[model samples]
Target: MIGLVLAAGAGRRLRPHTDTLPKALVPVDGDLSVLDLTLRNFSEIGLTEAAVVVGYRKEAVYARKDELQAAYGLKLTLIDNDRAEEWNNAYSLWCARDVLKQGAVLANGDTVHPVSVERTLLDSRGGGRRIILALDTAKRLADEEMKVIAADGRGVRQITKLMDPAAATGEYIGVTLIEPEAAEALADALKATFERDPDLYYEDGYQELVDRGFRIDVAPIGDVPWVEIDNHDDLARGREIACLY
Candidate 1:
């Protein structure tokens, strides 16, 4: 399966330190940065190819391509999103349209998790074009975290960033497997959303899928040690979870 590493973000939450460096290059664990450890984990999980979507400070990320390749001996694809500032995660996903295949592993560069996720997705044997790993919000969720209300049995669901304070349910772990058809449909949905509302976030695309009756399955990511490194506080927590390696 192909891997899509989403490194395209201005990292507005991570200031000062990120003013000069990309968030993906920031140190997470003892020695390895978020990008470094993330790739290592994917390599171990039987990944054949990887595409890193770089945007802000992409030069820094592009410069290290050779080093990472030499270290892992893996073929890596780098896609740039010059307009990352105007859009959200959905735009980044759109930037890699040329690189995305039939079944692609979608990962957020700012977050890190165990690579066993490959096996988890494989076990589900999804029939849809896109399926996301649904983390248990009960485990722990924040106001800024993305959440979903999945349908019964099938992974199909309506996903969104928290809209209500009291309706907390499931969290969205960044790991996702998007089938080519799903990716295309997602691109279409995003295009429509943007045409109407230029300020729309990528989450809108997922909601569109549900509206159109696309069976976007939700695979349970229960109890998996995953962390979204938004700042220094998250960095420490990520290290603790990284120790699971």
Candidate 2:
């Protein structure tokens, strides 16, 4: 499986840093950006190839593509998302449909996590599961977290940001293992999600999958030091924990 990164968001919350570069390029560890850590994690997991969905100042990524490749020792394929500035990540993810068909370990470019999260997902592969999401059961769920509601055998029953924190099973940490068997359906679901409401998140596509009777399992990452950088505070937390990773 290849590594897939959804790095198309403009991240308006992140100012000057995102003026020219995408959130993925925002540095958390000195010169090492979030994308750098992601690529490094992928390379450590033996994924020799990676596809990045780029938009909203994508030229920044293009300029550093060769440098990132050489640093990670992996080939990179960039998927363009023309509507990144106008739409949500559901469409950005849809842009990489072909790459998803090849199976992939997808990580949100703004997330800073350790290689253990990827290893946890990889270790949980098989047993007829098509898609496995990295769920953080240890984190205290809040209104901003993308919460999940899952059961022992029922898998994920719901995933949304609007859900009450009291009822959530955990938070999806933005890492997922998409098996080839679920790719086509996932792509279709993503298409439907964005076409229905261009503002919907890709997690809504996962909800679409559940609505269609597809089983999506969850792999808890346990107590892990990870942060999804969305603002200055998040970036600060990312810097503090990313170095530990």
Candidate 3:
């Protein structure tokens, strides 16, 4: 399976840095960028080919694509998202519908986590689960987090940002495995989600699939530190987490 990364968002909260470069290109550990760590993780787990959905500052990624590919020893395909600045990630992910048909271990470019998260999802593959999300059940929930409510912590009952923090089980860490069997259906769900509302998160697509009776499972990464870089505060936290990786 090829690796997939959604690096399209402008990350308005992270301005100046995101003014010229995408959030994925923001440096976390000195010169090492969020995209650098993501590609390294994918390579560590044998995902030698990766497709990155780029928008906001797409040219920035193109400028460094060759360097990143050489450093990670992986082939990179950049997918353009024309509506990236105007739309949310639900459409950004939908832009990758064609490449995802080959099966993919997809990760959000702005999230900082170790290769262990990638390993957990890869190891749990092929057991009747078409979609497997890397969840952090151990983290404290906040209103801004992409939360999930699972039935007995195995089957995902719901995934949304509007859920009450007290009632949610955990956060969906923006990493997922999409098997070939579920690719077409997932793409369709993503399309429906974006059509209904351009501001919807890709998690909305997961909810759509769950509503359609797809068996999407969760693999909880207990007590594992990870941070989704959105604003300046998160960038600091991401640096700390990057050291752990």
Of the pair 1 and 3, which is ahead by lDDT?
A: 3
TM-score of every model versus the real structure: 0.90, 0.99, 0.97
lDDT ranking, best first: 2, 3, 1
Across 88-133, the per-residue lDDT of candidate 3 in tens digits comes to 9999999999888899999999999989999999888876888999
In candidate 1, what are the lDDT values of residues 1-245, reduced to their tens digit? 68778887767677876897688887777767778877886777777678899988888888899998777667888998877777676767767776665567777888878877655766666554365664555555557878777657655466777555346457777877776666677777767776666566566777776788777776676577778888778877988888777
Q: Give the runs in model 1 whose Cα sits over 4 Å from its true position.
A: 127-130, 165-168
Task: Give lDDT tens digits, candidate 2, residues 1-245.
Answer: 89999999999999998998899999999999999999999999999999999998999999999999999999999999999999999999999999988999999999999999999999999899999999999998889999999999989999999999999999999999999989999999999999999999999999999999999999999998999999999999999998997
Which prediction has the highest TM-score against the true structure? Answer: 2
The residue pairs that clash in candidate 2, if any, are none
Off by over 4 Å in 2: none
Q: What's the residue-level lDDT of 93 in candidate 2?
A: 94
Root-mean-square deviation of Cα positions for candidate 3 versus the true structure, in angstroms: 1.1
Higher-TM-score candidate among 1 and 2? 2
Model 3 C-alpha lDDT versus the unseen true structure: 0.91
